[model samples]
Target: MSFKNYISKLVFCNGISNSFKTFTALIINSKRYSSRFKKNTLDLNNNETFVYHLKSGKNKFKFYLRTFKGDIDIFYEVFWRKTYDRHLSFLKKEPVIIVDLGAHIGMTSVYLALKYPHSKIYAIEASSENFELLKVNTEAFKNITCIHAAAYFEDGMINFGNNELSYNQMISENGDPVKALSIETLMRTHDLSHIDLIKIDIEGGETELLSRNNSWLKLVDHTIIEIHTPYTPSDLRDDIQPYGFEIKSEKDSVLFAAKK
Candidate 1:
């Protein structure tokens, strides 16, 4: 990590809470920093792999990190700092049902599990490596179901690209073929009658998925999607409006749509 990134992390850690700040300070003060924790800093960076055991609020997480492309900073930014959804108050279901596309290593899945303890989360990842880690990371959560398949408009096989940054993996004609499942098929296979929220971050595949026959979306109450503008047109809001959803675009390509 750069000097700026390191300092930013320290600031983020300090901002968590007085108790957490004190605990983090002890780690930094100890000369055994290298021994106590895996070196996640750029200076002592390990290219192969490392693990970060983190505690935020009342939730604990174990992240398996890789040096080549994964961004460890996202954990602090998204979960700890609440950069993605600051309020963490989007879903309002009693027993929430969430479909997480592009679950990656299950960070978001774990976040949802912690926030909504009674919720059922289906975490789907396309890449085999990411799916393996997804299962490992989420195995302890009985409410979380990890699937090694792509979410598309139809049931079939499509080419998928595996990237070192787990989030960047997407469907590409030049990549290897992988099984694809539609939203209806997933809901049917899992026996979900009504979906509270559908969180989509499937790179550019959102275009095709949202453009297709989305009759199944009537059962969904809300949706959070990250639109890839380069690969998809901005008129997706129009596409969803007809489905009785009111759309609001947020920073970082995120769109929030609630049922009207």
Candidate 2:
């Protein structure tokens, strides 16, 4: 924590407070829009129609999304930008393979595919419900391959503790007892080679995954991971260096690393 980072946190805290106030106002004023406005919004449950279409550069894309609910904003343009999207958009080429570990609802997968159509995406999600929606949302993209499995250190079965039913899929590296899988098995099964961008948000399992699978470091070029456990940033820094990767940047709890 430098002086600049301290000041940035202060600003971000203030901004978050203000954004919550605004979101509260929107919810309170939802009655003003009436049922007509709600009806006009796409029925995302039905996959027949395009919810909304936007052209990113020249390519046209469709996305099935609902507005914010219960004051969390729950939307990418709001929450994810501050942490993950900063360096994610640098990709724009074909034949590039992206590994999306812990891909929740396929939102990041859709973004990656739309941003880099020529690239193939290997999206891994363990949550049953979220993975289903992820599959539905990404059905249009030909390049995205969805995997409904958790990535871990050893090759075998492990408990997937999914209490929230939304996010938070942590591998039980310390015997916490959650869903588990073998990363080595997946690698051997898929015959995966080069990974251009890898995004991991599997709770505290990142440490165990990285520490256990030392061979995987050679497969990936860039990795963006959300670290949300007892391990300090310095611990992660020390662990990753041995695998030939160095931290490129970090915001909040998320770390962006590039291969050395």
Candidate 3:
């Protein structure tokens, strides 16, 4: 983080006046500064990205991204809007293991890492482009491990297609080949005996995933997923309820399931 980039993030997140106030606070009251910053975007690597700067106690974190509509909406939804807080309210255990599917640029992973700093998190992304930024954002946290693979029902190469909406990329027959890992495979690769929280937001592809050979549900205690078109709430209920998850949908278009 260079001085130029630091000031740029300050300006992008907080306006000039607030940036000045934050700067002065940092220099004058460095030890007492709590994270009350701004939200805005930055132009980086020929793409626009959302930039947010925060300080927790004596440590500082910057979530910088390079993306399309995905950056703005996802960042706002996860950070300012508190999209997952409701779904995640049941997480009372510490030192838990988490797997994040469709971890686009790692906003959710970053948020979760901060919320559960002692927990281990695997942030998985399919797109090579998005994974780069995901790495950058999650690097500040030691608890987050990033994987470049799509969480499909099978463990092999699969067709990964893009969408006009940057956040909704999915596996398709017409798409390019990418490494596909299953829930079982992820657990095995990470040597995870059980997962405390697993997040799935792979567009509409969850229908196929939940419908497929999902014996892995036995190992998952809690899951939260965003439902897309053609994958209704009934579909989600029918797929996971038999596994004994008390399923409910939050207002922001996501379903959360926890073991009874």
Candidate 4:
């Protein structure tokens, strides 16, 4: 879909709108408010990458994005897509520890960092191109630690899908070899005793992440992960239910689990 058409279909998929409310949602909640630079402006139409400056509420948000590619889609999905918004009310003020499995050009990391200013966010990205942009986008935040490694079942060199597409990057035996960090290695390397929130979107790597006989799940309070094919929500629910998490809800493949 074209940039303009994608917005119309995505934001107004319900065909429900109010002129006053819909326009406001476009700024950060719904619409793609764009144009030249201003104090607090929005634009998701540019094809090139630039240091974008945006102000929402009292904070100024910055990100390096290529709007023509899938960057803006991910941006809108993370920053304004309502599917992820329901989880934010609980995290807005918490000084949580977050583990982002697929940082993807740092969209989730940057958005979460901005949302949780006191949070210590560990962003793991496997793509070299994405990691380069991740560093540029997240360099301003002191709380975010960017890790250029793929999340996998063990600590070793693993083949990773060339991240030509930002959201679908995954692990593959035929892809380029990259440093792999298991959940255990990540926790130990960062010296994290427990995590308040864990966001897993590492393409299809969740199979290796949760199917293992690992002890990390018990140490996390919350989890929001997208389950790719060959794995169902029931598969994850079965794996995590034993670890003390109750399945709160799900939207598509994204499941929300929290300790009860």
lDDT of 3: 0.75
| Residue-by-residue lDDT tens digits, candidate 4, 121-229 | 9999997777889998888789999999998878889888753445666787678889988888899988999999999998888987898855789999888899999
Q: How would you encode candidate 1's per-residue C-alpha lDDT over 1-260 as one tens digit per residue?
A: 57886677666666543455444543343324333235644333333544545555665555564434453544555665565464245545543798899888787888788777898999998988777778877876789999889999999999997533546788887778899999999999989999888888898888888888778878888887878966443576767778898764466677788887
Give the number of the best model, judged by TM-score: 1
Clashing pairs in 4: 25-30, 25-31, 26-31, 33-42, 34-42
What is each predicted model's overall lDDT from 0 to 1? Answer: 0.72, 0.63, 0.75, 0.75
Between 2 and 3, whose lDDT is larger? 3
- Lowest summed-lDDT stretch of 10 residues in model 3? 29-38
Q: What are the root-mean-square deviations of the candidates from the true structure over C-alphas?
A: 5.7, 9.3, 8.2, 7.8
> How would you encode candidate 3's per-residue C-alpha lDDT over 84-196 as one tens digit per residue?
98878776675389899999889899888888888999999997778888998888899999999998888889888654455767777777788988988888988999998
lDDT of 4: 0.75
For model 3, which pairs clash? Answer: none
Candidate 3 to truth, TM: 0.79
